[model samples]
Target chain A: MRDNGAMQHSARRDDTAAQPSRMQSAVFLPIGDEGRAELVERRIAEAITGGLIPAGERLPSESALARSLRVAPVTVREALVALRDRGLIVTRRGRNGGSFVADSADPAQFTAKRLGAMSRVALRDLGAHYSAITRACVGLAAARADASEVARIRQRLANADAADEKAWRRAADEAQTEIAALSQSARLTREQMRLQAEFSPFLGLIGQDASAREQQRRAVLAVLDALERGDADAAASAVDAFVRDSVALLIDHQMRLHRA
Target chain B: MKALQATDAPAAVDTVTAFFQRGVDALGEGTRELAADVASARAEGPLTRAKLDAIVLPYAQALFDRAGVTVYGAGFIAAIGLLNDASGHLSWWQGPRHSKLELAAQNIGKEHIDYSELEWYRVPVSTGKPHIAGPHVDYLCSDEYTITVAYPVFVGGEFIGVHGMDVLLDAVEGELLPLLSGETEEITVINAVGRVLVSTNPHRATGDPVRDAGDTLTRYECEGLPLAVLVS
Candidate 1:
């Protein structure tokens, strides 16, 4: 019996050690620092993006985690609190108690309603960043993209065409997301996604002008064409020009509306 | 002689099952009542500490009793009082453990556990994926063992948690085996950390890590189970 217990203990230890490998294969980056709350937060975020932490899953309790990590319970609590404020996790009390991850995917209409709640500056800043980042993405895509990726970009443009103003906005957003995804950099993709979420509400507020929409579509197509041609410099320059012009147009429109 | 007799007899799995089933039912009912109380409290405006406890404690106690579960060596609700801020004062509202758990259960029958509170649930500055908390299970049968089940919970068009019950295996082998159907397949529950919370086969109850269970007749298999359905 004692031998059985000892063997079981050793096996369990091996299993625990093996668990990290399983997570690593699934794209979850192991947290490095013991006490740094930021490292914990970043690891959780990466896990979420990597799909290791599925939507609506709960986190471990503070006491349980503290013991496992060899850290103070307070540190765990602090990290959880930070996650909660970001609207990532929700908490409850009573017999069934714990925290859970929140789902970010919502319909276009829902996204629009949320966007309507943003401050003016938030919207403006978001527009600026989207314009800038998207432009960079298109340019990079033009230089480094392959035939299949370029085909995917064209399909996104077609989706944009099929959508209404709101739907088009969503399609455009998806297109930008795909661009980041194609970059194959988990860190860069996360950063861009964060920026996009922050400015989503403002992006929804932008008016749908037929001529402007057509111009944007043409610009995107042209950028894709440059990438397909392998003209990296030209593609980058075109994207830069498009972003500069779009920013100016948006700023001018906003100023005119304010003046009126 | 009585204590020896009790120990000599195997623990009853039926009793353990009944205990857990009763506990889950009680928790579910208590959650509904708590939801109503929270709504009323919110409507009453900023609540004093006394009023909050006055409203919550009774219901919490009732919940623990109904579930046949104890906390801090007493009914589970008593454990609520132990959570204190740096000042040693009861700090319920400062954390969202209760709210998140309640919401998770209500929204999805799953409960979430957090190892780090200060980093995940802090106010103001936020870090990590705001919508993604961390790795957690949607269902928990017990602190040690959990079973995966079909049929997820969806509230307000969202998956929240999972629902299941746990049984103490030693007790089952000792007392409940005689009561169970002869053809009843072996059952066992394991938590995220791979601890055996309960089991039906007496030979499986070694009080060791669950992952160590080899292909012995006493060992149970739980492959292809959803990670969300286990205790984490």
Candidate 2:
């Protein structure tokens, strides 16, 4: 006897509902102390950039976070305050109130002064590091990922390209993470997320320019195309070029600001 | 008595497999989080092998508890320093139990114990899969009969190293010994290579070669492991 599609459809619906909470636990838990407050704050910030914690989501309460993290309640409070100051979070005072991720109404902006203050050496080193990691990850993804995994990555890349300016920063960050996950190594994915978090505040500066945004999309698409074809060499080269070009542009912009 | 022992084998196999599977999953998750810590540590400046090991130390404890193994070690292919924890459990070579750090320091000077060449670490890095490496002597950690489980740990898509767990063969024997009590006829557990790992018969010891009984002995393979239950 043939059953209706209701059972299968409902099963999928249940999965969709369960996914965010699972992602929340996976992203948030297992946070070891590298200076508890700083690490926790950085992780939460990275989760936001990686799209693990969506905008407008309410954060766990301070005590609850403290209990789960095995940190003093005051430590979570301090980190939350720092996040609020950075405009990454907002706090509500009412009875039904808690900390919430800031709405994606405006992208966080980095000024020319901030860019110029960073030494050329530091900027170059950061870019070189990311280039090394991401290239290796993309190559492995090309060699290992099946068609369906490639499709998921392509979809994320497309979402980033289509996003509005305010949401594009996070969307692009997530696209990089999605590609890393296709490498099928949890370690690679974590490294990608960490590198993205480290550079995202600076990368937001370039997102304001439409031409720059288009260039990024094209660069990612090239990598995507190579991965879909299962060409590891091409995939590595495309990722290398993409990261190299972005670093070059950022350095050029920094030099211009310094000259001005 | 023979019937009771027969019924117990399947249940015991299920319990053991589930235990180790959960351990593998937990260790994998812990090591991924450790990789993130390593990346962040790099953001501050370049990290040396010892510094990297230091960053890994706190996270290594969970691998021991979760895997239900006697000791857990994470060794890099290129690094000189290895991060490991055994919860201060001493091996047969020690006079009194010492800290894992002391044990590691004692073992570090030996030229014979090359982690790079060990099958437990090497096989997983080459194949990028979890592997079982012993039922032989673990010269470095326990100096007793041990079995090792090694899982490849990759960061940035590079095969950086392996995460390994060493379970004392005696400890495994302790866990399996109780089930052997009810059997009347000779019942033995054998490794993949036909060596007796555990036996209900008092005279037959572990690590001894199983004597050929030809058609008299029937062997059943355990699920998800290279082990067999033998009946006569």
Q: Which candidate wins on lDDT?
A: 2
For candidate 2, lDDT tens digit of each residue in A1-260?
Answer: 23437645655666668455665446445556478788778766655554445578777678757754557998889899988988888999999799988896232323455578888888889888888888877877776555654675576556554447646665676567667755644456667656876676566667668888887778778888898897989988887887778878888888878788
lDDT tens readout by residue for model 1, B1-232: 0112222322333343454444445545544454455446646675443454565555444533443543211011211122232111221210112221222212111122221121112211132111111111111112221121112222333322211122233333344345443524555544333444445555554223344444432322232221111111
lDDT of 2 at B65: 48
On a 0 to 100 scale, what is the lDDT of residue A8 in model 2? 54
Clashes of 1: 71
Specify the highest-TM-score model's number. Answer: 2
Residue B15 displacement in candidate 2 (angstroms): 14
